[model samples]
Target chain A: MPVRLFLALLAMFVTGEAAGQVRAIEVLGPRPFGYFIGDVIRLQVDVVLDEPFTLQAGSLPRPRPVTYWLDLKTVAVDDRGINGGLHRYRLALDYQIFYAPLEPRELAIPGFSVTATDGAHRVEANVPAWSFLMSPLREIMPRGTGDPVYLRNDTGPMILPVRRWLSLAIASGIASVLLLGLLAYNRAWWPFSTRRKRPFVQAVRAARRAFRSGSGAEAYRAGLLCLHRAFDATAGRAVLADDLSSFLKTAPAFRPLEPEIGRFFQASRRAFFGADARGAEADLPRTVLIDLGARLAEAERGLS
Target chain B: MVDLSSLFHHSGNRWAGVPLLSVERLKSILLVNTLVVAFAAFTVSGWLAFSAWNDNRVISGLATGRDIAVGDRARPEILLARGQFLMRRGRLDEAQALVPAVRISGDRRVLAAIQYDLANARLRTALRLIEDMKIDQAIPLINLAKDGYRAALSVRPDLWDARYNLDVAMRLVRDFPEIQPSSEEPPQETPEKLWTDLPGLPKGLP
Candidate 1:
């Protein structure tokens, strides 16, 4: 293809030199058939000049999006060594066509002008325009007229499964929190500050600890005082051993522990008022106090 | 996209003036919501599974049913239908990817149809193009379709449709010649000697 172009240029150059000028431009590719949108075409421009003239390097075309749907992608100028005193300039131009035509049609690749200088002797020459075939993307033939190939139908998105999962997760989280909260409320934990262990329950815990530590007489005395305080608090009055029957009537919760209550009072009398007070061995030993407190605590459960 | 902290902390405290957001009622409300949401999830998953089954039904139906042209592919059956269309159009990679996804109410017929369509699509197209394309290019599609039809028939021997298509495909494609195995090679006897080797026939009948 280049040899044919060179021969064609040679003929043009002979005529051009005889006319005191030489400029030949040829678009080499983009065959005349099956041309689609987004196809790039290549063109070559050869210029030969008579003596005292040189092709201007700075005058070549700059690449740009040239038209509505066409772009000049690249531009290159090569120096094909001078032959027979005719300066030769080869401009390789690349153009991309993005035109979509329903029917096959011709689209021109606009031409540009180049400059030649001979030390203050300058002349501008123009390359004539060229054209190539342009065709549409879709096939031109029809399959059937009754059920025409319609444009792409609209597609509806299915409900994403993640939304269902997310909702379920949220609900599960809330339910978990609710279950924990209910448990806390019922079990007398935090945020249910009003719910507290009864004083007798506290007394039971203290006595049980005293028994475990084997803190003999002092621990036993401490357990008695706490039991008295719990009895007084439950009866809403100071409860003495003499007022035991009245305390039981007022706080019937202690009725089930009446025997243990009487025992605790008798032991308290022996441990505190009797001469055996401050003895190394307590009449109401820590073990007995622990059992008495435990019975009272069991009765306390029925009260509430 | 749902901010759970905000749902817990936000002004969704009351519904219809019942103070539903208060801690007092929040527990019950949240518990109920949890149950409802779990039910919703189950329902949604079930609904989606049902649609998938329906999608398979439509896909298998597209093999021989109407309104299944290339352009009408944006339906519930689009997932498999698109693959089938692409396969018919000779786009194999995309079609193969959709083969494992067919399920019509967990029916095997749908699976058979899926396989049948995948193979028969190319077979039918190749037959159409036989007049236009060289024999070398058309034979591969014929063989592929033949194999697919055979596979479907193997699973459901009663599938007359698959049987018919198999017959058509067999005419276009031939299986490799079956060679019988033998311990010893046959005797390399000449045509004249074969008569002498025969026990019942006279050696010089002529």
Candidate 2:
């Protein structure tokens, strides 16, 4: 009685396990031969489900590279349209075999799980693993060749391509340095560096200091002397009223100051040697004379 | 093209030489200079950050292999590294197990994996020969490994590493057997291969 009960129980367990796999899964080749590195292979899968289950989205394995060499390139699933329970999935794989095998050898392709969706309960089925031969490029033992194939050696770590970035960084670094130099050269802001002072700039500063606090008439004389000294130093010759034309020829940088030079010469003639000193003050106001000196200094600084 | 020739004619270009605006505008220089510096920093720093991220991925991959997460999809880069590690430690079985996947993604890196496997394989044979006190038995194995390195070099000349290992191999089996090449008989065993990790054969054959 015990033996009969055990046999009955074993049969029931086996039947239950078989019944749970409501769908059938059949996996075809990774293609039998003539494969090498960087080649693509095709595999066909057939899944037949029972009456209650229907194939739908997410029912198949997600398309991804099964292994580094074997990539799942494309996945196309077809439903028989009439719902005859024959579901077909065609998988395309791109592979590259680095092994230069001396003889024809087999390589395995790992299989994955497929899920079939019902109203609430999901039935799962396993797609058995499959393999195929990878044919060698050359003979296992070449007859006469002195150079024969040997084992592949280890590889080094990957070195990042930093050439592009390094070049850009170097270029930008140079540009910034040049720009900084231009800024420093233009501005006399850093006083330690020696720079030639324009003659007109020096004269303008001297004139401003000459009239600080004194008799208006004496200050007037001092300012006139200051203007005469600037013109003589700039021309490298005494610049009398008659020599104004020659002065303009020698230093075209002061061409804009032609009118101002004429005025200063007239004021000089009246202030030092004229019978009436009052006329000198009226001809060139103290304020106008100082402003003329300032304008000339600005033009000098603008000189390239 | 404002016919700048006319401007040059004005008063021998002395007054005109002075740009209408004096004082180099420091604002523009500073702005442009700042922009250059920023761009430089962005490129260099970006690469550094990327390198760090790559290193992290490799670290995570090592952990994944150590855990022996069989079905877990380790990145190809990580798998290559782990395979190399196993080979170096003389765990040829574990190393060869990853060969199919590594070999499939063939490139120069594959040459590297091949190089590692060959060196380790030679080391295994050399150690075995030493244990048996048979120095002569190791010569062909070393020569075969050198030939493998040479074949790898022929595939890629840019591998200085392959060149170095080839040199190492050449030094190991210092002189070739002068008498063997003329003979018609091919060695019964093929040379060491980069792919399968076959067990070493018993000694006593030429």
Candidate 3:
């Protein structure tokens, strides 16, 4: 009868404990010893609860100076969701210890309670106090030293990396100048003004000016000579009437103008060599000669 | 009796029997496009070079211990330099004012350096006050210095100097819980009890 009563009481106690919503609380951290001044200690706390209950975020500890010698640097919480009918919450806490102990001393991080609620029911879970041993950073006493307390030197201001920007600027400036030079070359600007590539253009201008001067034989001869000069320049040498075929073969770009060129050469021979200037004028009018000059200029520039 | 006009017109499209844009017009179009690009490049290059030059000047001025005029829109590095200069000149308040500006800087190193320097300045001042037996006046400065060191260490944990200084400050004055006034007790004995509760000089120090 006495054994039966004892067993029944123990079962009641176990059932009462299990009836609470919070299931378990576990705290994990680094080794509890060998910490010195300015060392950070990280602790992780995990709380398990029934599926319906959720941890109250507001009840969690806010980062602050926990003690005079210890600073609670950061606190982070992660909800692991529900697994196997248990809801889990993980809390990460970072604390920096600032105690300069003369000898190894034990310190306690105070415990706090957190609440979990499922709208209608509220349950409390306790995080137990943690203790750690802090070691001294330096000797308790110095023996015959000139300087008893020596602090570390301060960090100086650092110079920004300006050389990289300077180099980039220099490279871009060089590229811009080179491009500008290219533009100048294409536009035939200063130092390239005399290197005009369009000789037929100059011939057209000269022939127009001579035709405007008068309709006399002298003016016609001048215009014809201008055209002859243009041909010589284009061929890079004196191109006589007989060299027409070779010039056409070497410069296929002017092959379309072969018939007109041949007519001009015939008219030139009649006037200068055959001494029939009037008949040559009839064969090739001034307007025709001028128009032919313009066409040659256009073809030379690849415009035709 | 060849019709010259017809012949010339035929020749216009007879070059390889395909009409194409004139070479001069193509060359001119290409030249204009290239010129615009080059101009843009030149403008960008000039701007970069000028800014770099200006920044270098400011850096050199700071290195030589010259007081540079800081603008509201000054760069982080410039603000840091100014803060360091003020701290070195014993203007702790002005240097402290620059903290919020430097705190927002993207460069963690610069932020840490400024905090460390400012903390050092405060600690040095507090030490002098302690030498003069003005312990009451020095407590706040030491506390502020400790806070500064902590902030610097948060950003750059490898800052050994800041850590060492913070430890030194801690030993000078240990932190304790703030006393909350109890309505049941008389306020007269509070000051005396607080003074007694304060820790005395550290142990093992002459």
**DockQ for each candidate?**
0.02, 0.06, 0.25
The C-alpha stretches of model 2 lying farther than 4 A from their native spots are: A1-33, A37-113, A121-133, A143-149, A152-170, A186-304, B1-206
Summarize candidate 3's per-residue lDDT along B1-206 as a digit string, tens digits: 76799888878758867757878689878867776776676576667667756876786687679988786467677877788778878988997888787776577887888888888888788777865767777778988998888888877877878877777776666555545666555323232332342232332334
Candidate 3 or 2, higher TM-score = 3
Docking quality tier of candidate 2?
Answer: incorrect
- The 10 consecutive residues of candidate 1 chain B with the worst lDDT sum are B194-203
| Higher-DockQ candidate of 2 and 3 | 3
Put down candidate 2 lDDT per residue, B53-137, tens digits, no spaces: 6754564555444533332244445555666556556675676576566555565566455555555577556646745756557
Error of 3 at A274 (Å): 38
Cα lDDT tens digits for candidate 1, B44-119: 6656556655555555655444345433223324545655556545777666565555442343654566567776
Cα deviation of B49 in candidate 2 (Å)? 16
Fraction of true inter-chain Cα contacts (below 8 Å) kept per model?
A: 0.03, 0.07, 0.39
Name the fnat for model 1: 0.03
Return the lDDT, model 1, position A231.
Answer: 77
Question: Chain B alone, TM-score of each model?
Answer: 0.48, 0.45, 0.64
Model 3 residue runs over 4 Å out of place are A1-19, A142-149, A170-304, B1-53, B183-206
- Model 3, docking class: acceptable
Candidate 1 deviant stretches above 4 angstroms: A1-146, A156-197, A213-216, A273-282, B1-206
Interface quality of candidate 2 as DockQ:
0.06
Residue pairs clashing, model 1: B13-B21
**Would you list the C-alpha lDDT of every candidate in the order shown?**
0.61, 0.60, 0.79
